[model samples]
Target: MQAVPNAFSVLSHPSLDHSGGGRASSEVPRPATLFESAELLKGGKIVGIMHNGSLYRLQATKLGKLILTK
Candidate 1:
């Protein structure tokens, strides 16, 4: 099976070069990783996530929405 990415990136504005006086146009950032909820749950209704030594639960509701709780 393919390994899942540990982190996902969100779209961010162009980075600013503090000393360069303009946006760092030459430094292209890596594209964000995307994952489908079905892939994450693996055909299950719920999944557990461990973050910073704490447990988080991701649940899919009957209404086709998702919720995360600590």
Candidate 2:
């Protein structure tokens, strides 16, 4: 199956009448990085993502899909 666009959009949809009523809808500050998909490769189909002193592995699956792991 394919991934849906804006997978996080449901959190802000008006149709959901949650008690909070969009209190946290404002943008959360995040570090932005401009990189291309090709740059993620080290040599093969693997790359590394660093966050909070932890290392994460991103790899292209045999099925031509991406998977991330800690």
> 1-70 in candidate 1: lDDT tens per residue?
3545553333334443454555544666655656788989999999999999999999999998999999
Q: Give the best candidate by TM-score.
A: 1
TM-score of 1: 0.59
* Candidate 2: segments with Cα more than 4 A from true spot: 1-35
Query: Could you give the C-alpha RMSD of every candidate to the true structure, in order shown?
Result: 7.1, 7.5
Task: For candidate 2, write residues 1-70 as lDDT tens digits.
Answer: 2344554465345554354673543555233333445557756888889999999999988787888999
- Compared with the true structure, all predictions reach lDDT values of 0.73, 0.64
lDDT of residue 35 for candidate 2: 43
Give the Å shift of residue 58 in candidate 1. Answer: 0.5
TM-score of every candidate relative to the true structure: 0.59, 0.47
What is candidate 1's local distance difference test score?
0.73
Collision count of model 1: 0
**Candidate 1: which pairs clash?**
none
